[model samples]
Target: MKSPVRVMLIIILIILVVAGGTVATAMYLKHHRHQAATAATATHQLSAKEAAALQVSLPQMTTNLQTSGLIQFTVTLQADKKATKNELTLMQSQIEDSINQIMRQYTPDQLRNDKGLNSLKQTILKSVNHMLPTGSVTNIYFSQVLVQ
Candidate 1:
């Protein structure tokens, strides 16, 4: 009788341990999935904001880098929606010219890196905003990039 009781208690203990471990594993996975979903939602929200901004594709331009190579890329400018089509059209040449001027300042190696690409975007955004009085450019998008 004593041996039977001890065996039953041991079996119960093992079952409890397994159940606890299963619950913990499930909770951990649920928490991890929630965090991943939150991150994805945040990214989607940012893209939605960008979509709201007015987008204008600049003409493709080619410029020689300071050192040895040439860089060619198509740039798209995201401006404030308040800007009129006529206004943007009128300043199109100036915007393109400003972008070209800033592009000339970067070396081929610089444009190839993430940091350099960010810098170029900032430079173009600031320069384009300075040229426009009604609508300010919010972001710069590169449709295509080629460094040769």
Candidate 2:
């Protein structure tokens, strides 16, 4: 016959093993779910038709930099939805003015690299989103960027 102490020890060991497994499984599932969500976001891409429907393209703009030189670029703003696009269209002049003001803050050398251009785009995106009563700007694309 088994001793009482031995039986109790075995029961405790079994409980510990089961509890550990349950905790591990819960953690593993949570980690994988988070990874899957991140992967889906990273892989998602908008089709051309979808992009066009949500985008507002501004005409070519020419402005002088902070101190010297001239910069010319065609900006395309991507809105979060159709209503935002329509709002952006209606407020095109204000958007242009904001872009012009932002451009003046940078020098020709500031917008010469991808880093600078990306910074400019982020700044524009933030500014435009602030102007809108609803919805928001998701991105900014510069089709043509010339600094001379």
Candidate 2 deviant stretches above 4 angstroms: 1-44
Reference-based TM-score of each model: 0.62, 0.71
Best by TM-score: 2
Question: Ten consecutive residues with minimal summed lDDT in candidate 2?
Answer: 41-50
lDDT scores for all predictions? 0.80, 0.94
Colliding residue pairs in candidate 2: none
Could you say which candidate leads in lDDT? 2
Q: For model 1, give the 10-residue run with minimal summed lDDT.
A: 44-53
Q: How many residue pairs clash in each candidate?
A: 0, 0
lDDT of 2: 0.94
Residue-level error in angstroms, candidate 1, position 45: 6.8
